[model samples]
Target: MGGSDSRCLRCGSTKSREVRIFDDPQSLSEAVAASNMPKEIADELEKRISSYNLRLQKPHSAESHSSQHVAAMMDATGDDGQLTLSSLSRSLERMDIHGTTAEKLIGQAEFEGRLIREGQDTWSWLQQSS
Candidate 1:
């Protein structure tokens, strides 16, 4: 409702400002599609919605979300991405993922070359995977 510099609350950006859709998902998706929003914002909304749907449909599918979270963490960790088991455990806990899931996800990431073991309870991101 401000001037040309009005910020979008969802994305905190000034470009492609629009209203939030609170109706059914089908209608909301259609509104998003027809809006003048940026592609990145649209894609992010889609991803978040998809992730939420997946979590609702399959509670045990948290592993998939964990992988995505791990990748995001790696991105934020920079080139020499290094992490400890305790740190990873705490991160997963913050995401509401507990128990052996964190350890399992780290093992899977290492197996997929997304991460590499550096030492006991320590790991590093594999830049080649990015």
Candidate 2:
């Protein structure tokens, strides 16, 4: 058979590299274990793969994520200590949270008395009573 195409359409380069695809970390670990690679190198790869798997398994609930965003927005508030809807929207967008989820988070904050509407597009953070 003829040589495979090595040209990259976007970069217009002919350079190519071997790519290994694994369904999951377990399979990759299995492959590494079965390989004849050096012990130290294989150990390092396993460590990295284990770390990646741990991160993937970490639980991140919507409530916790929203709370974190709210805390960040509070910290970012100006001297007036007000958070604008636009600002909150931008922050949420940066966090990859948008659309109805963003709307719901805003509504939830207001419902929980964490925010008080000060104007049409602005809100003031309500400090929790001790």
Candidate 3:
């Protein structure tokens, strides 16, 4: 531990910082509660919470967890996010990553100006290899 700027509660190790838990409303509320902050600060921070309700939200059932989906991400990313339509979907039995994370990865790839969506479950990197 170089300094006392931060501490890990489990290991009592210094040099760790608090991490925001923003996965869902429940987790977020717990984080906000454990923060031990004042009402004003909590209220203000609540406005900045990032919710992933839409991305993985199923209309009639709870969201699913698919190992196949992680496999798909690994393939599409190829240890990177440059992907092809066939490669991406060949492994995706279901899209179960946190909706926002999936969207962010896709959006980031797209923002780098390369993501191409061919159909509902098809996509590829458009800028070739840079």
* Regions more than 4 Å wrong, model 2: 1-60, 98-102
lDDT of 1 at 56: 91
lDDT of 3 by residue, 88-128 (tens): 54445344334334554555556766577655644565656
Question: How far does residue 69 in candidate 3 sit from its true spot (Å)?
Answer: 14
lDDT score for residue 52 of model 1: 92
RMSD of each: 17.9, 15.2, 18.6
Error in Å for residue 78 of model 1: 8.8
Off by over 4 Å in 1: 1-68, 71-80, 98-100
Instruction: Give per-residue CA lDDT, model 2, range 1-130, as digits (tens).
Output: 8987788889988888666899999999977776768889878988999998877765655556656767657654668888776776676666665444445656777998888889887788888989
**Model 2, backbone clash pairs (residues 3+ apart or across chains), number:** 0
Q: lDDT tens string, model 1, 80-129?
A: 56777677666666666544565776788788887788888778877773
- How high is the lDDT of residue 34 in model 1? 56
The residue pairs that clash in candidate 1, if any, are none
Between which residue pairs do clashes occur in model 3? 77-80
